[model samples]
Each structure stands twice: as C-alpha cells, then as structure tokens.
Target: MLKTIFPAALILCLSAPVLRAQDLPDYVGSGQCAACHEAESQSWQGSHHQLAWTEPTADTVVADFDGTRFQNDDLTVAFSKDAAGYHAQITESDGTTTMRRVHSVAGIEPLQQYLFETEPGRLQSFDVVWDSEEKRWYHLYPDQSLPVGDGLHWAGPYKNWNARCAECHATGYEKNYDPATRSYASTQAEIGVGCEACHGPGSAHIDWAETGKPVEIPGVDAFGLTMRSTADSEGWIQQCAGCHSRREAFGDGNPVPGTPYHDAYRLMMLTPDLYFPDGQIREEVYVYGSFLQSKMYANGVSCMNCHNPHTAQLVAEGNAVCTQCHSEAGNTEFPSLPIADYDTPEHHFHEPGSEGAQCKNCHMPTQTYMGVDARADHSFRIPRPDLTPITGAPDACTNCHQDQTPEWAAQQIEAWYPDSDKRGPHFGTVFAQSAVDPAGALPDLLKIAGDEGQSDIARATAMYLMGAAADQQTARATAPLLRDDSPLLRAAAIRPQRAAPPQEQFQNLLDLLSDPIRLVRLSAAPDLLRAPVASLPPRIAERFGRVAGEWQRSLGNRLDFPETHLVLGGTALTMRNTPAAIGAFREAVTQDPQLLDAWVMLVRLEASVNGAEAANAVVEEALQANPGQPDLMAMQRELQQ
Candidate 1:
C-alpha cells in the first residue's frame, strides 16, 4: 500500500500563493473595458461567463425562496427570502437544524447553486440546486446520502468555493489561504469573468488609450494587453484552456491571464477515471483535454473559431458551425482541409431531418453532468464502433442504440463501409490493454510514446501509464523521449527513469533541472533530490536549489488541499524528518478525518516516538471517523496485545 500510495504522492507534488485587491495595481475593472468596447460588453451581458458568479439579489436569485420546503429522504431544507437576503434552514438526519444565509449564487441556465459562508472566510456550494427550466428545487447528487462529515457533503473541502470554483467564476481572484490558521481571506477584482479574465489587466491598455492611442509596429501590442492580438491559434487556445480545462493549478487562484498554460497549471492527460480509453469524456473534463486529441486542434483550430469570445456561444447553429470547414465549399481559412459534404444522410446513415443525422450526435456525443447540464465532446472524432470491443470504450452508435451491442454496431459499420481505413488500430487499444496486462502492452506503449504523428497529449499519457511497469528495459526504451521537444513528454518521461541506477538517474536528470519549462524542471527536482546535492559541483547545486525552490513553492500554494499535506508528510518521511512527517500526517487527518493512510502513518509515528498508549488513542479516533475498517481493527488489536 505504501509503494502504491507513495509514487502517486510524488506525482501529485510535482503536479500541484495569494494576492489582495490592493496588490493588483494593474487590474482595471470590466466597467472600464466597457467604455471602449460597448458592443462586445453588451453582447457579454447575461451570458454564462458574465453571470458565472454574482451576489444574491432580487435579479440574481431565481430560486423560489417563498418559504418553500424541499425534503429528500431524511434531510429537509426550508428556503426563505426576507429583506435581508435568501437563506436556507437545513435539518439533518439527527434533527439538528442550522440556518445558512446565501452569500452568492453560481450559474443561471439549467441549474443554479447557492453558496453559503459555512465558516468564516470559507464559502461552500450547497448540494441542493434550483432547476431553472423546471422551476423546482432538487438535490445535485440525488443518489448519495452524504452526511455532515463526508467529504462529498456540501460543507466539506471539496465543495469549497474559494479554493475550487472562484478562480474560474470570478476575474482576478486570489485565494489567500493561510495554512497556519487553516483559513481563507479570499479577494477578487470583479464578481464574474470579465474583460481582464481573458485579456489580462487593463490598466496598461487604459494608459495606451488615454495617451492618444499611439499606433505601434506590427506584432507589437499597441493596446498593451497581455494576450497579444498577433497570438497564433495555439496561444489563443491556451488562454481559454487556462480556465476551461480540468487541471491542477500551480499557485493561488488563477495564474495571470495570458500566462502559458503549462506554467500555470498541469493539464490532466487521458486517464482512465477522467476519460474513456478512446479519449471521450467520461467525467466533467471540460473541453481542452478532449480538444487536444482532435484533428481539428491539430489543423490549427481554436476555441474562438467555434465559440464567440464575448458571448460564449457557438459561431453558428447546428451543422453550419461544422460545415464551415467540412462542407463541399471548404473554408478559406483552412485551405488544407479536404472538401466534403458531411451533413447529408448518405454520410450519417439516417434520415435528413432526424436526430441521428445531426453532426454533433455522431462526432460530439453529449454527456449529462450535474443532473441537468449536457456537454458535448470536443474531440470531433468520427464514429468508430469497430474499436469499441478492443478498448471497452463506448461508441456513438451503441450510446444511442439502447438495445444494441458493440458487436452489432461494428457489423453495421463494416456493412456500410467495407473498404474503410478508419478501422485501423488506435492508441486506445494499447492503453486499455495496459490496464489488465501491463507486461504484454509495454512494447506498444513505448511505440506510442515515440509516435510523432499522435498528439503530444496522447504520447505523454502513454508515458505516464508506463510508470506501473517501470524497469531498466522500459527506462532505456523511453530515454530518447526525455529530450523530446514537447514539455509534456519531457516531464512525463522522467517518471519511468526511477528504475535506473543512482548514477544514471543523476546523469540523466542534471540537464532537466535547468530545463526551459518550469514544469519540466519541477518534475526533475524530486527525482534528483534522491542524490546528495551538497556533493555535487557548485553550478549544478545552484541549479538544483533553484528548481527545488520552485517545487517547494508549488506545494506551498496548495496547502489548503488535504492531499497536499499527504504529499508533505511523504516528502518529510523521505528526508528522514520524523517529527515533521508526524506533524504533516496529523494535519492531513485533521483537515480530512476520512484520510485513512494519514491516520495509519500518524499512529505508527506516534507509537515509535511516543508510546503504545499514544498510538491506541489515535486508533480510537480513526475508528470513530472510519468505522469497521480491517486495517484499523487489526492495528487496534495489535496495540492492545
């Protein structure tokens, strides 16, 4: 269990600061932006991005708070509105009632979630939400019976608005979390995602405007914006992906707008829990990760090509959005695209007016999330029922055909296009095969890692999955990819090298300690720490210190997260700091009592350093938090003996 959990902790540390309003001198509000760009600002009004978060008001609070009572199983919540504001009285299974005043509201269309100040400086998103379409209240997770202590409960850390949601919802947000006191002094420049959220701070641009708006040379930012107008497709895409993608942020709140995505956050790759093996959305992965795997993204397509930046809506309705490039009269913007008619029934194999004939229904299947919202896949992939059996990933055909098997769908695909070349082996086959048979799938995984034709994300994911089977042979095979041009591949390639000899590890990671990308250098710093830094040359030691400081700061930014404490505890244990490890483990379990491994580690350390009585006391606390656990029970019995 230690081996399995420790490696993950290292990765988490590699993967994962505060500001005040007065600290941000460059951020001019969106109201200032509207003065120069009225048309864009007006278009943005009432859009989801504009209303992502707002204070509770008569206009904003749409839920029925006229003393309405909503009961679910043993829990009953009464919502009421007074001159003060919207409020909820929640009665638990134990019949204890607590009154909570709504501090803010999130979203507007399909559903709206209320946020309550559960603790001083800590805002939590309530589970019960209002369905705008149905005009009724409902629980977001109707299936689960999450009690007060459960992490999934509304008041838990996972539901923290400041830590989890505020960065994306509000512009120029800073989650000022003080770890010593375990509290937040959060601040934001504005209530919602405004002009500066994507375009960066506007003070410089305002200066540019007030000083007669001097014209500058081409490629120079005349407007003084962080996101340059001359930015290419990839640069523009990263701007949107900074907030849209499901990723682990590196620092406090969101990074400055227009910062490189890799520098700000670690993009989650195609992992089994978050995505299907075929790179379809399995969880709420948002758009960026799936888009990275698409041919559209490969051909220089970006978010703005389909979505209006200001309005956050599709550029065109239905098939017109796709046919701009896919149709017989191809778009001039993409001269390389092959002209083809994809919206016809002959291509989709359905009646022209039917739902099956829709381009999105096949290429971008919708997955329902939050019970009411349905988000379409952005991969823009062709329907390949043939690969479903091999990958165990859902196909577009069988997803809609409730009674049909994947084999049936594959047969139909074969009957329609017998000579098609789309049935060739995909990387998904190798990824899925790796799960059940790592040794057998390793050769193919290495091949995929080296395949330049595949997306860098896919190659990086292949390298990440190969960590389970790390050995000298696997490390040697993947060594060439360590110097790959892509930062993602460079970062992932370091994981497998853990199997190499100590001298080999030192030699291989020395250059990466000063790698151009911060993420890559941070990735190498942990593995390089195993070597004695003081014994190294002066220049090399300095490089290690700089990168190690970056790694430490990255961990410091995420101290609010319970798992970050777990990583701290693991790092302390590795450095032979027993007391520090004990403190970290204690903090981890205190923040999240359900953290079983932290409790176990804490008990072990207490028993060694203190006494069996101290360990027994911890065991009793662990049993109270997680009752009837075999490991804790066994530990308790041993301590008694």
Candidate 2:
C-alpha cells in the first residue's frame, strides 16, 4: 500500500493543486498551533521566517511605490502604487518597457525585495531591492550586468519562485509543476515558514491533545503530529538544514519534518563556488553548510542551542552567546571540551568595548549579499590570522583593524600563543591553493583525503576537488573512498569512475545502485544507465530501470528550469532517443533562449534530421537574441563550413 501510494502521490503532486492543511491533512496550520502554544507563536510572529514570504499589500510592502526611479546604466525601473496594485515599469537594455505587477515581498529590516509574477505560478524576484534601513532603492547586483535574455536575468528561470525560492519561504509548499505545460499551481499550508514548517503537521497532535492521549512512548518524545523523533535526536537539525543549507532537492515534494535530509535532497559540500577554500562563506549559502564544519556541531551544538527556535534570534546578545559554551566552567553536557575567556583583551586582543572584542568578529566574520544583507559565517572557528597571509582568506584581526597588516596580526598571534597547535600549517591552505592550481594542489588534497584525523566534510571536499585533475594517481587514491563509511565520502569517490570504460563503470556502479543513501543510488543511476542495459544481468537491468525512472522523475519535477531539461537531453542522447533528445533540448531553449549549449545541441540534432538550412535558421534566430555569443557564433561558423 505504501509503495502504491507513494508513486500515486507523486502523480498527484505533478497534476493537482496542493491540498490545504484544513482539508483533513496532517498540516493543520500555525493558527491551530497558536491556540495551545501562544507564547511560541507570538515570538515567531514578526521573525524573518514569518516575513520570508508575505502577500503584497500596502502594509506588507516595504519598497517605495510613489513613482521612485532607480537607474542602472541606461535601463530605468520606475516603481509606483495605484488602485490596481503596486507595479513597476522596467525599461530593458534594448529599449523595451515591461509592466511588472508586484506579486509578493521577501525579507524586511536590512532589505526588502519584491517578487513579480512574470508567468503563471512563476514569481521573479525584482532585481532592485529597497534598503529599508537607508530608505532608498538600489540594484541588488549593481556591479554585475545580467542582460535581458540571459538565464540569470530577473525574468529568467533562475529567479522563478516556484522552482528556486518558494519551498524555503512557505509552509508545506507543494511545487505543483507540470512537466507537460511547464507551469506551477504551487500551494502551501501558510504563506510564510509557519509553526508546522518546523514542528511538522499538527492535525494528529491536536487530536491527541483534545483526547488527552499519550503523544510519546517510554524512550521516544515525538509529538502525535510531529516528526517521528525527539528533541534529543538530530531530526530538528536536519529539518532546519533542509532550507538553511545550500542543497539540491530531488523533487521529493514537501517533506515531513523528521525526514532524513539525504532522502529529500543532496547536501552540497564546501565547493569552491560557494565557499572559500579555507571554508569561510564566499557566496550567500544561508548558514547550515558552514555550521556543519564547526567544532560546536561536532560537540553537539544544534541551532536551538544558540538561537531561539521561536524568534530565530540569538539566545544571548554579544559575547554572552559564545560564553554559554566557551567559558572556563564549560557546558556540563560537553565537559571534556576546552574552554576559553572570549571577551577579555587577553583572548580577543582588543579593548572590551571594541568591535574586535566580540567572539563572532574574529571567528564568524560576515559576507554581504542582496546589497544590504550581511550574513555571518556560521562555521565558528578560531581567528586564523596564520592562514590570512597564506590563503588570502580574511582574518578577524585584519577585518576590524583595517589599518593593521595581516603580517602584524600574525606577529601578535604568534607572540601570545607561541606553542599553539592552531599556529601550524592548515588544510585550508591546501584547499585554497588547489582552487587556483589543481595540478599543484592534487598531491596535498590526496594526503588530506587519506588522513583519518581530518573531518569527513574536509576529506570529502578533497575527494571532490580531485575531479579538477582526475589523473591515474588521483583516481587510485579516490578508489578507496567508494566504500567509505560516510556516504558523502563515497559520492566523491565515485567521481573518478567517469574516466573508466562502460563495462568497468557498469561493474563499479552496480553495488552503489543498492547503496543505503538515496543520493549515492540516484547519482550512480545516470552513469550505470550510460551503458546498454541488455549487456547486464536481468536483475541488474531491472534495478537500473527502477532507479533510472526515479532519477528521471526527479529531473522532470524541476523541468521548469532549462538546466534540468539539458540534463534530460543528455540522458536521452545516451539512450539514442534522438526525438526525445531534440524535444528536451527544444524545451531547454524555450525556457531559456540564451541557453547556449541547449541551442548548440538542438542545432546539431536538427542538422541530422532537417538538413543544414533548418539548423542555420535555428542558429540565426538564437544569434539575433544573443548577439556575438562566442559558442553560438562558433556553431554557426561550423555549420557554414
């Protein structure tokens, strides 16, 4: 029954509008939660989660709507409010004016961004943001130029709320995306991240509450409607990280709060694009990715330890937050851990009231995103003044003392902790070096991967980076990790298998097809499917078909994005389904006209079927939209020859 229901539910998620919480569903809405836990509900009222997504109204909308003009280069966006609703006239680079209706708002305080419904069930976050504190409008990416037709454009698939932003912002969001129509009827239990979003669906709990029944067993502390785990378990952390971490959802739909993270999404490691090689926040990755790397996490520090789950505010202000666990007395739960005097000048090397005196100032630091939004690095670590000079990652010492040099900070650090273990050469130095020169860093990364002392994440990242220079030596080194205890490590190890022959790959990925982790099994599906299934044993072929179907469904769930279509096209090409490949490529270009590779592939496929004239016309149309695009130009030149 469960197996039959799961696939039927998937079809329902694909075709139907989402079921409301009130419709006898497990999710009974935050209002129901407020009836019993008013204190928690009230504390969460105006928190960031509550305001993550709010209906656009005179009260909710923070941006100026009184004919305010924000100019970026030649393009001008004029924001105004009227009886119809808040609207904006956006003039494009190529002298085209578009009227965008303000559908909803995202964020508050530091900055508020408006969302425009560019297409049905698709919300595009406006490029311009309102600086609520400064009382001014500014371009979110003032330094970067994203042209009108590009995928990164405000109207493009990258900014679509249905595919990218909605799940995190809303409660019980069902991204009802139709692969057939490329539309969404996406619905949520509540507009914002409500109580049910964390505590799980409430109907069952409410039933037990009214009847005075036991919601917990002798050892288990699970609520009747909550996830099937207790506070003591890692269930809550996994739930929070579902949205908080930088991850890729496999279109599993809205998950129950207690669902294992690997079952729903593929957690991204400390990749170079998102994090500095030294593991400081480089991009706007929210928080959980870095938090996973912290010693606090290693010592059982969950989000609730520092933050109020209700208000989402720090449990204490200033250094007091750090002092909770980092004091000489230390936390009773973690007595074996070393403690420090974080607030004093001896520890911080600054006056008590100075910015450098703060624990986070030296350790967490910050990176600014959305112009005014500054997020702290959650990977709490000791101030690496030692690595600043080596890796060029910002040290807390140099950040506050802008006048002082990194060498001076290093001198002062060495003077205090002359025999400090922290003063030694770090793996981050190796990680940073690899990003710039993979050939030089591969040997060092291999050493990091083999070392048992290093954290699993660090070792996993090392194995991942080997893809840059996946030579025979690197492949040999990574082969051992294919059977590592950590699934994250095994996933990295499988990267080198791309260099092997089809028969070898079939054998290599066969065991992984039945791996416990969904991430490993699905990742292996495409590779195993690359070889002809007829060549394999009947049972193995059956497993391949089942896994491949699930994998393709996951891809189809994200069909609103052109990149997913590109993946589908590649998969179709492997199976020699030329029509399917052409259709997938066509869908890719339809969603994102400036998707260069999709157009090139479409042209190549079209040339084989409809001759060069048809392919030339396709290239000509693409060239008109994206003038002087090097890849498309090269394709056109090749076709002419």
Candidate 3:
C-alpha cells in the first residue's frame, strides 16, 4: 500500500573550530557582519534565514490578503491588515471567534508556514493552509470534517513552535514556556540565525582582538573557538547533523560542536513504522541517519565534501559533483565504477540534461518528509526496481513511473541490466524465493547477513528475515555488526539478536545503551532486559541502572506512545526492577494491545512475580487484543499448561 524507498558533501567552511581569543569577533549582530562579509551576508539576506520572521508589512505579505474571504464549509476566514498588525479571523461552524495575528511567513514556493506571534517574539504554529492545486493560499490544517478541538490537528500544543520549532529556526532562541505559569516569555539573541549562532558568542574572540591576549570562552574548542581541520570531520558533521539528522535530542543541547555524534543526538533506529524493511525512509525522519547508512558516508564522505557550509550550496554542477570521486573510467584508489558514459542516457535510459536523466533521479530518489516537498534519499544507491517486491524497498522506477506497476519497473530493469549481478550472487533469486517461500529463503538470507561486500541495507534486511525465520546462526552473525562503524549497520545488526543474546551480549547491550541513535539504544534495551543481570559486568550493570532511570523520568506519561513504552520497558527490565518493567509493559500493551512481544513479556513477568493468575490474565488480554496471532496462541497455550 505504501511506497518505501531506501536511501551532501559540502567542504567550504566559514569559521574554523579552533580560534585564538584574538581571532573571535564581538556579537556585532548580523547587520555588523553584513558590513565586511557582504557576500555571505547578501546570500543569506532575503533567503529563508532572513525571511525566517517578518513583521506584518505590505512588502512582506505575499498572500492575496487584500480583503480576501476564504471558507471551508461553515467555517469562514477573513484577512485584514492595519497599522497595528495583520490578522486573520475565523468564524467557526460552532460560532467560535478565533483571531490569528500574522507573525511571520515560513517558506517560499511549494508550501509555506504562517506564524502567529503568541507572545512578543514567541510565534506559535497556527492554522494557515496551502493551496496545493492553485499553488496559492488555503488552510492546510483543520479540514471541514476535523474541528480545532481534535488534538491531532495543527492547533494542538504539539505543533506549538515556541516549544518545538523556535530552537532550530530562531537565533539564540529560548523556549521559555514555564509549565507553572502556563505562559511564555521567549526571547532571542537576534531575530534570525546570524554569524554568532553557529560560531558561538564572539565576545571572547573580540575581547582577545582588543586586548591582544589569549582568553577563554565557553565554546572555544568548538566551531567558533577552534580551527577547522579534517581531523574534526566527525565533529563537524555532528555539529551540522545536530539539526539536520533525523534523531532525538539526548540532552538539551550542551554537546559541543566537535563532540561525538552519539554524545549529542541519539539517532532513531530502523523500525517498521520509521523505515521500510529495505531501509527506505518511511516517516518524517531527518537526513543524517539515512545518509550515514550510505557507502559514500562510510568511506569518509561528509556533508561538507559536497556543500558549502556557509551558503549551503552544492560544490559543483550536476553530475560533476559525483565525478570528483567516481571518474569516467575508474579511480586508482577506489575502482568501483567501470569505464562507461555516466552522463549520457545510454547508461540511464533517459534523455540527457532532463530531470529524469540526473544521477540523483536513479541514485538519490526523493521521498517526502514533513508532508510536503520530497527529500532525495542520500544512500546513493544503484537503481534496483526488481528488488521492490523481493526486498520490499521502493525502487527508483516506481518513484517516477508512479502510474506503472513494480512488475513493469522490473521488466524495464531487466532489459538494461540483463546480466548484472547487482543483486549479488543468489540475492535476486533467493530474495525472489523469500516472497514465495520464506522458509526456503532462510539459508541464502543467512549467507547474505555474513557477506561483508553486500550493502549494509541488504545485509540488515537479511538480518530482519532471520528474526522472522527464528534462525540462531543469523542472529549470531549479526551480533558483531552492532559494533560496526556505520550507525545504519549497527541499527540493523541488532534485529536478530533481540532474542538470541541473553547474558553473553550484556556488554554489547550496555555499550549501545548510549548509542547516538535512540532506535539502536531502544532496541538494545529490550535485549539487555532479557539478558542475565548476574553475568553483566559491574560497570555495564551500573550503566543499565543509570539509563533505565533516565529513560523512566523522561518518558513520563508519554508511555501512551508505543515507542516511548518500548524504550522504557526495555530499560526497565535491564535494571532488574520487575515492578517498573511490568508497569511499562502494561502501558505498552495498553497503547498497542496487539503488540505480541509486550503481551508475552508481561505474561512472563507476571508469572515470575505475581503467580499464575496474573500471567493467565495477561494471556487472556493478548488473545482478546489479537484474534489468532501464532506467537500469542503458542504463548497462551504454554502458560495454560
């Protein structure tokens, strides 16, 4: 039903990470920086950064707000402007008076966000619609069937920018929403992102300039404080990826620019909801996690390698950017690409210079995130439409030829790559076999898991099959890959090990408890719980307790979210706190009653602690939740016996 596809180098930098106190500049504001750094400043001016926030003025308002009246069913909206400010008033079907003041315009072209200044400089996401067809203005949120009362709609607290969006978009922004007061007094160092934002406070740098002496500043060793060196590649990447990547913030934002990525944002792991089985982007995941999964990234490729960090521009034109490493013939260092006409359509099967012929179309196909504009996958994969049904990843073919079927895409692919071993040995044949007979595909799937040359995604997918197949060898082989450098590989490596490693894998489990990706840590947490605590080292055992406590406090009542409960439940069991474990498992069961794993674990925990009665009740609940899940039926029968 859903199309799933698997998944920037920028090199030019502005400020070096290492800087003498004298090298720093004072917080002269963007206007001051605009004086000397005119080029960079001008590029940013009128761009999204400059237009991040705009006052209600004729020049700023692009929408046809000149006495415009828009209606959706019984609800009517009237736009008006005055010397004081611009406002939109909506008269709901229930006679509700909703007055929305225009605070700022979000984006240009495809879709835009209209900000409503909830307080001074504190703008909140409000009901501004996009006219998709006319490419104009319409209410994007709150359909005629859905009322503002529905918490899932845009008007809800979850969508509030003050709490969610401001930190990233606004410069020196403080999300000063006090739950005690139930109000906000948010302020910013400056309106939009400025030089000081990424470079750290220039006060120390400026002080050194005036005094001619070295001085200490907060973030001197970071982007602004230090010099940029290739040595800090991981650090530099983490700094940009802090915002760019699809990950959860582990702590507030204290992690330094050069800090290890895992120390800052915890990357979310591959899950059925977040990703397709073939490691394609599924939901609204940010890019870093996906990009890191690419072979290009693993082999020292970085965001800066392709993009100018300051201007955020591509390093070169078209396919030329790719040719830097991938030559027309072959590279002396990495001889992957054969001698061929890459730019021509003979290789691509599309007209030259057309959008369809672009290397990105086949290699980096787009998948939509944030509900609107499509984001190109960074995996830099070779097109494999044939793997769509076999691997369950959306192929580049289905992406463009949406009207056509996967079978059509596969047929087209066969014509081009007739003798191509892109599927790697028995992958194509075995993967195809898996679709028809999963049992038959188990051996080849296990072999694929151990193939080092195979794409990490394909290997990961193989590991996933092992879990469904319940193969011990596949789980054992995957355990070592958890220590793999690529987060994507590490994330997938844990899938099969979910049940196999009980005590021997406790150290590995503890090691990943602090993984940069939440998905990996979350995945490992459950494994850790099932592991024998007595076999765990004192240090690792202590880490389990620490992480479990932290997870509990942060998760709170958000346990209603299945992900929250999963992470919490896993950590709870690892700490050997059975009561907390039972509670978390119960909450998980409550949220998704059909979660077979949760039901089984809860029944086991209840049986081990509160006797057979509680276990029987949990089994009964599991049965009620799922009509006839094989796992549940088996577990229920075992418990009854």
* lDDT, residue 579, candidate 2: 81
lDDT against the true structure, each candidate: 0.84, 0.78, 0.61
- Give model 3's clash tally: 30
Which window of ten consecutive residues has the lowest lDDT sum in model 2? 4-13
- Model 3 earns a TM-score of 0.70
Q: What's the lDDT of the predicted structure labeled candidate 1?
A: 0.84
After superposition, candidate 2 runs with Cα above 4 Å error: 1-25, 82-84, 144-147, 214-222, 436-440, 471-476, 500-504, 532-534, 606-615
Better structure of 1 and 2 per lDDT: 1
Task: Order candidates by TM-score, high to low.
Answer: 1, 2, 3
What shift in Å separates residue 546 of candidate 3 from its native position after superposition?
Answer: 4.2
Candidate scoring better on TM-score of 1 and 2: 1
Q: Give the candidate number with the greatest TM-score.
A: 1
Residues forming the 10-long window of minimal summed lDDT in candidate 3 = 1-10
In the range 42-111, model 1's lDDT, one tens digit per residue, is: 9999889998999899989889999998998968999999988999999986688999999999989899
Locate the minimum summed-lDDT window of 10 residues in model 1.
1-10
- When superposed on Cα atoms, how far off is each prediction in RMSD? 3.8, 4.3, 9.6
Query: Please, what are the lDDT tens digits per residue for candidate 2 over residues 236-350?
Result: 7888889998888876356666566776788787887888878898998888878878887877878888889889899999888988888887899887778866568887777
Best candidate according to lDDT: 1
